[model samples]
Target: MQIFARNLTGRTLTLSCDKSTRIESIKDQIYTADNEDGNGISPPQQRIIYGGRQLCDSRTIEDYNIQQFSTLHVTGSLSGGELVYKFIVVVFSIAFGVPILKYVYRQYVSKLIESATESIANAQKRATERVSGAGRRVTNNRLSGRFK
Candidate 1:
């Protein structure tokens, strides 16, 4: 049976394959076809998607229920170096990012608490001074009135 293989550049190739054909064989054929067109894509870098599912190399076409003349979309995968770089970025973010974020959050919360405490202390001091001043004024008024 023949199936249609489409690449990212809208290039399609009719591949002759059987239901028992492994997905790896299809990838090899795709690589050869792409190389002929000067694309130079390797089999490992080629990702075949059918029915919205990625085809595994170890699986057969019939395993995924790929029908005859069905269109298989091919996409290039990320290089090993790119995958390693992404892994490193994720590891570093997890290792250092969490601690840095926690430190910043603690500092912010500490400053907020300190500011609130100072505001409350200042308010209490003002209230105490006002109450004492009022009491002193009343006492002076009473003393002055008694002397008169």
Candidate 2:
């Protein structure tokens, strides 16, 4: 009998098998078929799912009641090496990303402080100039009245 194996990319493989065929054998056949098509997927990395259940290697095709032309979905499984690589990437991102964020925050706060200080200095200078101008006007008025 022949069953169909459908991959994540929607590619279908027509494989020849029977009820007595082991799930492991099916996986091997899938690996071969995929490699022939330049996919390079190994049997250990291939996960076969049918009827919402993952097929076990020790079970036979008949054990799962797989019918003729039944579509078995093939998905990729992450190996230990792949898992380790992903972990390293995440760790590095967090390790470097936090420091960069802190630097940017500090720079922004410094600029804000500097701008506020400059504004306060300008306000004080204006107030002092106004006070000094008033005093000079009062003194001149008093002197002119006395001379008259």
Candidate 3:
């Protein structure tokens, strides 16, 4: 059976597992799992290499028949129960909490800026009124002294 993994970006990768070999033999190296059963599993990180890099750990190939035509394709994925836990803790946390926190922070900063601007404008208006009043009083005193 051909193995496939679909990424978050909607990309699908086809993995080559020989039809003759039972899934159990390649469980650990090709996929991740808590149990040693032959079911397909996903690993967190895997690199695809033809010749230079070793395809899988020796333990993965123990008692498994890998024929000449049976080439293995390795993929990185989160498999089994660990994958579920990671999805709940990491993915759900970021998906829900980040946007809410960002929105609340943005609103608070905007309100604070608006309040500060209003306070500054009020202070300027009061200073201008006081200065104009003082100037008028001085001019009145000078005129009264001249009249007297």
The models' CA-based lDDT, in order, is 0.83, 0.83, 0.49
lDDT of 2: 0.83
Q: Model 3, residue 22: displacement in angstroms?
A: 72
For candidate 3, lDDT tens digit of each residue in 53-140? 4444433322344444444444444446867655665665687765554565689999999999999999977775664342453342
> Which of the numbered candidates is closest to the native, going by highest TM-score?
2
- Alpha-carbon error at 132 in model 2, in Å? 68
- Among all windows of 10 consecutive residues in model 2, the one with the lowest summed lDDT is 132-141
Prediction RMSDs, each to the true structure = 16.0, 18.0, 18.8
- TM-scores for all candidates: the values are 0.54, 0.57, 0.26
Of 2 and 3, the candidate ranking higher by lDDT = 2
Q: Let me know the TM-score candidate 3 reaches against the reference structure.
A: 0.26
- lDDT for 61 (candidate 2): 95
Q: How many residue pairs collide in each prediction?
A: 0, 0, 2
